[model samples]
Target: MRPSFLSEPVRVRVPATSANLGPGFDTLGLALALYDDVSARVAPAGCHVDVTGQGAGELPTDDGHLVVRAMRATFDLLGGQPTGLAVECVNRIPQARGLGSSSAAIVAGVTLARALVVDGDQRFDDAAVLRLAAELEGHPDNVAPCLLGGFTIAWTAGPQGSDGAGGAGAGGGAGACRLEVAPGVQPTVLVPDERGLTSEARAALPAVVPHADAARNAGRAALLVHALTAAPELLFTATEDRLHQDYRAPGMPATAAVLAGLRAAGVAAVVSGAGPTILALTSIPDEHLPGMGWAAQRLAVDVAGARVDRGRLGHAERDPVAAGRKS
Candidate 1:
């Protein structure tokens, strides 16, 4: 069936995310105050994309664009054919910086698709969008929080003999649970001039690890949840890891050094996502910001993951604003 075109432009805002807060590996993620804004209007002709801010000159401006591709994928999955789209993207998340830029794009695309479709369709809810985004991104950790907000734990439900196992609209067997992040826990990120590819970072890890190291990481991951919740003081030890970070260290020595310095200073710091960007969880008052810097920004936990507005956006809302800017 043919999909109804939007009468007005649809605006979608998606938050940037940091995965593996510490030792949770591919299971934990949190949405940050950073965001990307995308607006779409149905066109009678062909698809076109206009980008500003990050990756303005390099990212594709056609159907090959990630956001547009995601939208098309969603339409294909829903068994509907949508009209051509003219999309404008104001991107803030840095690309390939281990900061969930790609995940944000996927979430934005799916959200935009949902917004453009006619209302009363039962298949376009949050869970359905999340599952689709995860499938497009090939992992649920980053996309879960990007779609649902707060802290999220994502896992694959896998095949079982149950009636719903691996069924359609079941998120391809993925599951996610959102956790509340305490008010005192502040998140700051250090982004370097250099960038790291997620694929290269994954390639650096060994296929196997010592059982002892795995056990330690598992314990710290559990402790991290508590530390982020009740005991902010224990974050220093809670964010410790015996897995991926160390293996990725060689590729991003400068980031590793910054992480070590932050840890030494008693701030809970770890590689943000894959590498290159370091995330520090601290309880220090706003008066005192972390001193050592490549390019650092203090961000808060985003309670709202992604939102869609049905009408035209105001000037301030449509413009490409700096990340974490006070409104």
Candidate 2:
């Protein structure tokens, strides 16, 4: 069936995310109040993209843009492509800062595409949306929290239909559980001026870890969930990671230094996602800040996640400087 498109423009607000949360590795994420506002409408001729804030000049303005590619991929899944597209992005999330900026873009694109189509939500559904976005982003950690909000524990469900007779048919897709953060759990991100690649940070990890380290991380990862949800004081002990941080530390000495300093001061801090950015789960004293080269911002937990609405970019959404970004 050829799906109908909506004439009204659609916009989406996607929250920035911090993944790993220490020992949880690729399985945990938290949605921050920081966000990117994006809007799209079907065009008559060619694809046109307008960028306002971050990555305005550096990011692509046409079909090659990450958002556009994601939209195109979604359109393909929905039945057919629109004749043209006009996209406007008022970005606030810092790119390549281990803050789930790319995942936010991908979620916005997927959501905007679905909203642009009539009865799109019915056709695609929320579960399908999460699965597709996770597939596009290559992991559920960031995308899950970006889409569903709150603190999320994400994982890839193995292939289904392995009932001895049917034999695995297809993958079960991405799955996640969202939990409310305790009132005392404050999230502060120390973002660096320089960018760090997720690939490079990942490559620095050793192929295998000792059994004891793995076991210790497992306990801490479980404790992290409890500390984040119910017991805030235990966060300092819960957020310990023996799996990846130390191995990747040499590449990001500044981040390592600050993380160690904050932890020594009894702050529950961890390398947000891959590197360069540090996420402090507990409040940090003024005396412990790294001083310069890092922008520190305390953000609220976004419980609503990605929001889609029937409208173009309004005055507030169009503002390039809003969305809790530190100058």
Candidate 3:
């Protein structure tokens, strides 16, 4: 018998996210101009994936696909089932280049899976959807902004209550509070070809940092929010970090140089996520920026976070007006 054909595919578009800007560590993040798109298609009761862009030569094309793994894990968390799957990818964002490629894929999987199980109907709860994305992506900083738009504050537990814990989707207890987003702002993502720092980067630091450093970061994190909203000029002083960036320098030499490049050009930049991609908070205008040549690629802020369509997966429609749903 000939193979059975399935209905049209369920699409998902998860935006590229930047995390740990300066002092925020796992607590702060912003959505960026770049994106990696994932698509979930119903096939004949099995699993298959096709990866193009960035890591196509190195990434998997079958059940082992990271995008597939993320989608499956999401459904598992929600007690859903797999029918069959196919994935088509577009690689506007660079992989392993510190641009939230992994978070993008994880969000895509779960978001698309939910769309399929429910027949691509209904507006999936944004808060609940982000919780799922955070679980898979390892934090809400990157996921939340990608899903909700604008700069966001995410918290992670201090791990056994060490007093540094924070996460946006926390439980009702005092430590578990909701994160917020503001409207009408633009972002700029500056990515360099320098390789990314792995989870191992944390191993280079002492188990504990000085309280002075912690306090300093707290002030900057607050200042960053102010810069994002009303006082962008403060960013030159606001985006400094005593915690993550200096510690990971060994892993990101080019990142350091590129950051200096941005600052010298009067562009306020922080290390994107862990490192490698420097997230620059800026107001968008046709006026050109100077000394941006060092970056591998530069893009404007995209307020539209993770979303879906019939022909694509988490495929974002660019205009906030066209989104039809508020961020």
Q: What lDDT would each prediction earn against the true structure? A: 0.82, 0.90, 0.65
lDDT of 2 by residue, 201-249 (tens): 9999999999999999999999999999999999999999999999999
- Model 1, 1-327: lDDT tens digits are 566666778988888899998898998999998889888888887999988888999999999999999999988866675667889888888888989999999988988887788761465667677777888898899999898889888876655655464533343556688889977788888788788899999999999999999999999999988887788878888899998999999998888776776776777888999978888888433333335446778888888898888765456755666333621
Which of candidates 2 and 3 is the stronger one according to lDDT?
2
Backbone clashes, each candidate: 0, 0, 15
TM-score of each: 0.91, 0.95, 0.79
Worst 10 residues of 2 by lDDT: 162-171
User: Model 3: per-residue lDDT, tens digit, 1-327?
Assistant: 112223677776666777777777877777765666666777768887766557777888887876788777756655555567877866556677667887787777767776766532333455566766777766677777777655677665434446644453344221223233334344566566556654766666667889999999999988878776676667768788888887877677767776776666666677787767677765422343325444434455566677677775333442222332222
In terms of lDDT, the poorest run of 10 residues in model 1 is 284-293
Tell how far residue 141 is off in model 2, in angstroms.
0.2
Most lDDT-accurate candidate: 2
Q: Tell me the deviation in Å of residue 150 in model 1.
A: 0.8
Clashes of 3: 15
List residue ranges in candidate 1 displaced over 4 A. Answer: 161-172, 283-293, 322-327
